[model samples]
Target: MTDDKTLVSRVLQGDMQAFRLLIGQHERLVAHMIGRLVKNNEEREELCQDVFLKVYEKLSDFSFQSKLSTWVATIAYRHAINWMRKRKMPMTDLAEEDHFKAAFVEEENPESLLSDQDMNGFVMTLVDALPPQYKTILTLYHVDAMSYDEIGQVTGLPEGTVKSYLFRARNLLKEKVKKCIGKEELL
Candidate 1:
């Protein structure tokens, strides 16, 4: 198997196969970041493609200061944020929101009666219903197995900020999951 440096060099030399290999290696990372950040399916797909293109354009500037995946993720995060800004969408800011208020009313919905499998899906839906910042931090930190520093790098946030966001996001998810399962004692 070609190493990342060798593959990168080959891509720099205009090898399409090498470029494709690079894309294949990092596509999932890009998709994970964009998918959680961008809710619209078509927009997510388009933004993902845009991320790779931006990666390609900026490939020469990749200084190996971080892991390749981190660099790719940084690009993905910034691209999604920029896209959101361009669309005039409000970026989720906790300070701008009334944090003390409940995010949703606990109505007697069908989700409360779902099976374990369905409950897991319901949990995911709750996660997805979270603000983009919460979803992004959760996916990047837990699913991507990135350290707070790595998440900070990817999102251009301070490490403390990353940690705080992760803590808050987890708490929010925990509250929502507990509500969905009808088990307040779980927390």
Candidate 2:
């Protein structure tokens, strides 16, 4: 595995293989960032391709102030947000929060309804229902294992804002999961 600087330098020098390597290296990161927001399979694929295209075009402008993966993630995040905006999707509205909170408060202990695998799927489903900003922050922090600062760089959010959103997103998930478990037990 070449270092970022070497790989980037090679790509800049017109090394096609290096460019391919760059794509291979970052494709999963790109896919993860985009997949969480875009539900359509075809659209996700197209968006991923577009993200790489933009990355390649903008490679010369990358300043190396952050990790290369962070730079790529920033592109992925921006593309996903832009796509959502064009579709008029709600980016930050937490309309479901109140419903989940009510359900959570009404329920007692609700953690025993699911096995690990079932809980994982259920949590991911809940995550998919969150607003785009929260979803992006959660995905970048948890799935990608990025620190708050890195997530901030990727999402263009302040470090403190990233932490706050992550905390709120987790709390929302907790509330929703308890509500879901309570409902499941009643069934």
Candidate 3:
């Protein structure tokens, strides 16, 4: 089991198995990014595969001027953008969205949202249901624990916009959490 740098060097030397090692080292990373950036399960799966393929094809271009993760993230961001363009969704501000209002607009009863497991699951499902713009922002902010500037870099949005998106996403989740918790009393 070689390290990433060693494996990268081997892959550069034309060893097919080196690619495997690279995938093994970064598969979870690729999946995490895909899952966060893409809400649709099918597209998430496809995008992950595409990222790995792109990584394999572009191995020669990696000059070690930057870390491997950064290079991979750059590819993922580009692919995600291309995917969004293909889907015909023009740029939209998720910060301006009232996600909870858009999804549950009406006041839901406590029971309507109560078990801790049920509450957590429902909130996560709701996040998953967010539009890609919001979902990507939420995922990058929460799941990846990325900073606003980092998220802005990845999403090609302004740092202020990234901050606003995260703020909005958290507010939406807080509301959902409250509703889910209320179910115990609503019952």
Candidate 4:
């Protein structure tokens, strides 16, 4: 397989196949970033295409300052954010924290939940209930395995803020999972 540098060089020379190869290489990273941010499936698909379009247009300016996936993810993040902003959608709902806390404060038993066969589905539903910003950070950190700095760059957050949000997001998941499972140390 050709390295990113070779593919990039080929694309810079107007190789369409190289551009397609680049898209194939980074599509999952783009999808994962945008999927966590955009809730609408059709819109998410369109946004993914737009991200690659933007990447192709701006490829000449890519300075190799970061991994290609990181750069593509940054574009995907910004594109999703812009799409939400244009639609007047709130990225992070402050009221959600209070509701999440309320859920955490409720009493329940983990043993009962352990009997259910679809624990993974249940946990995904809870994750879906979280704020979009938290979902995005959590996906980037845990799913994409990006560093806090990479997350910060992709989301335009400070490194410390990325770390803080990731920490809080995980705790929120843990708390919610505990609530569902009755305090069996879900995390």
Best by lDDT: 2
Q: How far is candidate 2 from the true structure (C-alpha RMSD, Å)?
A: 4.8
| Candidate 4 lDDT score relative to the true structure | 0.81
What are the TM-scores, per candidate, against the unseen true structure?
Answer: 0.88, 0.85, 0.73, 0.86
Estimate every model's Cα lDDT from 0 to 1: 0.81, 0.85, 0.71, 0.81
Task: List ranges where model 1 is wrong by over 4 Å.
Answer: 96-113, 184-187
Best by TM-score: 1
Q: Provide the lDDT at 171 for model 4.
A: 83
Question: What is the clash count of model 4?
Answer: 4
RMSD versus native structure for model 1: 2.5
Ranking by lDDT: 2, 4, 1, 3
> Tens digit of lDDT per residue, candidate 1, span 82-142?
9989999877675543432244565746354465447656666666667778778988987
Give the winner by TM-score: 1 or 2: 1
**Which model is ahead, 2 or 3, in terms of TM-score?**
2
Q: What tens digits encode model 3's per-residue C-alpha lDDT throughout 64-155?
A: 76557656766787787788788885545554555445656456555554443475566677786565667777876777667776677667
What's the true lDDT of residue 100 in model 3?
A: 41
The whole-model C-alpha lDDT of candidate 3 against the native structure comes to 0.71
Candidate 2 has an lDDT of 0.85
* Per-residue C-alpha lDDT of model 2 across residues 25-58, encoded as one tens digit per residue: 9999999999988999999999999999999999
